[model samples]
Target: MLDLPSILNLSGGPVGLFIGSFLASTLLPGGSEAMLVWELQQHPDQAILLCSVATLGNTLGGLSSWLIGWWLGRRYPGRGLSNERQRLALKRVTHYGSPILLLSWLPVIGDPLCLAAGWSGVRLLPATLFIGLGKALRYGALAGAMGSLG
Candidate 1:
């Protein structure tokens, strides 16, 4: 039986990094940071390429969540809050608007932030920009730290 990292390692390098980062940004449980650090350590020269790829993949994954929320908003229109989670998400999105998506890189609330942005009818361009920026900053920071150590 192969462990998760072992299995991911078999996928190899940047391609694996992209896949891992994408999944990590989704609702699915995953950790791309380790794979990213491993990849950077192995190929420090390709740091920019790796970080760009991870950011793009992760951004797309977040967009997927946003799309789901868009659909939910369209479907329900004016549905009442079903729970505290929905209430908070709606409140935040309405109050802060698309700029709030800057926090979409956060672990627990990140995905939901994207979802709320979509559900609130936050325009796609701004949502994409903020989400991409946030994820890029995170990957950049990680790569920078790895570079300093290496």
Candidate 2:
């Protein structure tokens, strides 16, 4: 007797939230905000667990893009930025280093930032820290907003 929203909203736990968050953080076209909000609405007591799960999934997805960039860097050492977007991402990554990953939760440019950080050889530890922190903050903010609304 479960409805579509019930299923998509992950009535069991935060597992679907994790998967949706992961795909959302990647270059893939999707988002987990709705799912997060729904999960929060369903399990108000488990806000921390839901946000943490979402952040972890999102951070890993960003790292996956970083890994792809690392492989690409090794494969094509002489590759050039083919467009303005890539050039801008590289410029920001080079100028700000892994600290720029604090903005990795942003859409449109977030995925590029992760890739550029890896391509420019930003240290994994710092990148992971910043990416996770940024994602955690975002989810925290969302939970806070939900708390206020409800």
**Candidate number of the best TM-score:** 2
User: TM-score of model 2 relative to the true fold?
Assistant: 0.88
Per-residue lDDT of 41-145 in model 1, one digit per residue for the tens? 888888889889889989999999899888988999878545676668778989988888888888888888888888889989999999999999998999887
Q: Candidate 2's C-alpha lDDT?
A: 0.86
lDDT of all predictions, in order shown? 0.85, 0.86
Alpha-carbon lDDT of model 1 = 0.85
Best by lDDT: 2
Candidate 2: worst 10 consecutive residues by lDDT?
4-13
Model 2 steric clash total? 0
Candidate 1: residue 30 Cα off by (Å): 1.1
Ten contiguous residues minimizing lDDT sum, candidate 1:
78-87
Work out the TM-score per prediction.
0.87, 0.88
- Candidate 2 residue-wise lDDT, 1-150, digit = tens: 768767665543687888889989888978877888888888898899989999999999999888877778888999965567767988999997888999999989999889888888888999999999999999999999888223
